[model samples]
Target: MLGAELREARRRAGMKVGALLEVLGFSARWLSKLESGHRQTDARNVARLLGAYHVDSETFKRVMDLCRDVDGGYLIQGHGVGGADEVSAVRRHEAAARQLFSYEAVGVPALVQSEDYMRELFGRSVHLSADEVERCVAARKARQKVLNVGVPVKRTFVVRELTLRHLSGDREVAWGQLMHLFWLGNTRKVDVRVVGQDASFGYWDLYSFTLMRSPQFRPVVHIGATPYSLLFDEPRDTGFYEESARLLLANAMGVEESRAFIAHLAEHVGESVSA
Candidate 1:
C-alpha cells in the first residue's frame, strides 16, 4: 500500500525521485530503498515525505498508516498488475478501492469478459491457444470478485455508443456482454451511462481510460491498450482525464437510456427474451 501510494503521489505531483529527495532533504538511495520495500518506513522519514509532498495533516496520517501496513505485509501488496497479472490485481483493487470509475471510450468489452468469449472472437486470426485464453479468462473472472467482497467499491462507468456498436463478437456474445452491462447498470454495483453518437465534444474522445481511488491516494487513471495498459499517476495528467470523464458523463445517455439501449441490442441475440 505504501509503495503504491508513494509512487502515485510522486507521479501526481510530477516529482521524480531525485527532485523529491531534494525537496525532502533526504538521500536518493533512501527513497529508492523505501519504495523498493527493502527498508522499513520510520515516522521521521514519513513526516519528511508527507511534508515534501505538501499533503495536509489528515491525508498525511492516512499515508503513514498505509506505509505501516505495507511494511507489516498486512495489505497484501499486488505486483505486476497489467497484462497477464491484471485479472487478480483488478479484482483486489476494485474490492479494496473506495471508488472505481471507468471510461469506455473504446474497447470496453475487452475489459468485461471471459476467455472463451474472446477466443470465439479473436482466436481464429489472433491464434490464442486454449491455455492462453483460459489464463486471460481466469484473470477477468478474478476481477469480478470485487462485487461480492466486503465494503464493495463504489463503481461509476461511462461508455460510448461507439463501444457498443464496434463490439468484437458474434451476435450472441455481443448480446451477452451488453446484457451484462444492462444488469450491472440496474443493480447497485455500478452507475452506467452511454455517450450518444450525436453528442458534442466530450471527455471520452481519447479511446478509453479507467480511474481508481482509495483513501491513501487521490486518484489514478490507467490508460488501456490492445497490447497492455499504463498508469497515469501525475495529478495534472489525471486531472485532464478527469475533466474528460466528467464531460463524457455530461454528454452520455442516462442510466435508463443506456439500459434501454442494452435491451435493444440484447434482443438481437435473443438475450432479452429470457431476461
Candidate 2:
C-alpha cells in the first residue's frame, strides 16, 4: 500500500519513475519491485518518497498513518487467501472497520448466529473439542454486543433465501437461529437483505464474503466463512468485492422484506417462538 501510494504520488506530480529513481539514487528494478508490492519498504523510504512528491501535510500524514496502522494487523493476502483478519473473530472488526458489508451464500452470517446454532455448528467440527465449543460460544455472544444500538460501526448482511429454510438437524436450534436473525435484522445498526431463490446473481456462486471499510486503513475483503478463507487488501481486488456487495444489495430483498422473509420462514420451519 505504501509503495502504491508513492507511485501514485509521483504520477500525480507528473514525474516519471526513471527521473524519480535517479533523484532517489535507486535502480529502476528496485523501485519497480517496491511499487508493485513484490518488495517490502520502510518508513525512511516512505518519507523520502513523500518528500520528493511534495505531498501536502495531510496526505503525507494519512499515508504514513496507513503504514503504521497496517504494520501488525494484517497478513499478506496470499494466493489462496486463508487466515482470519476480522471474519474469524467478529469483535476485532468493530475496532478495525467503520462499516462492514457481509454476504453469505449459505448459512447465517457468523455475527448474528444464535447460541444454539453456534453449538450445533461447532459441534459438527471434529477439530474442536467440547471445551472449545463452549469457549467459542461464550466469546461470540460477548463480541456480538457491539451489534447493539449506539455502536459506530455500520453493519449490513445479505444472505440467500435458502439460508432461511436451511435446517440443522435440531428444529429447536434452527428456530432459535432464524429468530435471532429476525430480531437482529430489525436493529438500527444492521441492514439485512435476503436474495430470493428465484433471483439470479452471478456472484451467488461464491460461498461467502465480507468487505470492511475504515478511515484508518485500506478496504479489505475476506472470502469464504470456513477456516480456510481468503483476505484481500489490494485496492484492485478489494474494489471488485466491494462492487460485488453493491450488486448484491441491488438484487436482494429490501430491509423490511428481508425481515418478513426470515420471519415467515421461521414461522413455518419449526414450532413458534412462543412454543
Candidate 3:
C-alpha cells in the first residue's frame, strides 16, 4: 500500500522516475524496486519523497501510518469478497464514495453487470474454479447493493460503443445486461454515456478507469487491468484521471442517446435470438 501511494505521489508531482532518481541520487533500479514494493525504505527516505511531492502534513501522516502498518505485517481482511488486494481496496473506496465516474473500453461496468454476464466473465478466468467463480459472482452481486442503499451513489459511466455491440455467448445475458444499463441510465442519480467507435476524440488504446470521491477523504482513481490493478489517491494522479474522464465524456453521446443506443442493441440481439 505504501509503495502504491508513493508511486501515485510521484506521478501526481509530475516527476518521471528518472527525474526523481536524479533528484534523490538513487539508482533507477532501486527506485523501481521501491515503488514496486520489492524493497522497503526507512521513514527518513519516505519523508524526503513526501517532501518532494509537497504532500500536506495530514496526508503525510496517513501515508506514514500505512507504511508502518505494512511493515508490521498488517493485512486487510476483505468483506467476504474473495477478491485480490486491489479489488478489496476498490470496494472499500466504492463504499465511501458519494460520487463515482467510470470509463470502460470494452464490456459492461461491474456495478451494472448482470449475474449471468458476471458468471461468464469469471468463468473465463483460467485459474479460477467453478466454485471460485460462483463465489466471486455472488460477492459482486452483494457489492451492487450499495447503488440502492440509503442515499444512492451518484454515478456516471462512459462506455465505448464497441462494448455495447459485443455479445457474450449467452445472448440472453448480453441483452439482460444492456437492459440493466438502460434502467440504470434513466435513474435519477445515474448517468450513462457511450462513445461511438468513430469518435474522433476517443483514445486510440483501450483503457478502463474509475474515479471515486467522498466527503471524508481525497479522491481516488482505480485502474483495473488484467493481472494487475492500481489505486491512486494522490491529487495530481486523480486529477489526471478526472481530466481523462472529461475528455471521454465530451466525445460521448448524451444519456438519452446512449440509452437509445443500448435499447437498439438489445432489440437487435433479441430479434437475432428469435430468428
How much lDDT does each candidate structure score? 0.63, 0.70, 0.74
lDDT of 3 by residue, 1-275 (tens): 46656876787789877777789888988777676555778888988899888988887887787666554322232333346322545666677688998777777778878788888888987888889888888888877876876776779988888877885657888888888888887765789888988887544225688888775456677776555456656565567787888788888888888889999998998887788
Residue pairs clashing in model 2 are 81-229, 81-230
**For this target, which candidate reaches the highest lDDT against the unseen true structure?**
3
Candidate 2 local lDDT, 1-275, one digit each (tens): 45556666787888887788889997888887776555667788888888888999987996777566444334332221111323332334344567998887778777777889977876787777788777767766665666763648788988788767765647788888788888876655788888988987695447577888766456766664345444546776677787888888888999888898888888876655456
Candidate 3 TM-score over all chains jointly: 0.69
Error of 1 at 127 (Å): 5.3
Name the regions of candidate 2 deviating beyond 4 angstroms: 1-40, 43-91, 224-229, 270-275
lDDT (C-alpha) at residue 239 in model 3: 76
* Candidate 1 C-alpha lDDT tens digits along 96-153: 5688777755556344543456555545445466676565566566665565556757
Q: Of the candidates numbered 1 and 3, which has the greater lDDT value?
A: 3
Q: Which candidate gets the maximum TM-score versus the true structure? A: 3
Order the candidate numbers by TM-score, best to worst: 3, 2, 1
For every model in order, what is the number of clashing pairs?
Answer: 3, 2, 0
TM-score of each: 0.64, 0.66, 0.69
Off by over 4 Å in 3: 1-81, 84-86, 202-205
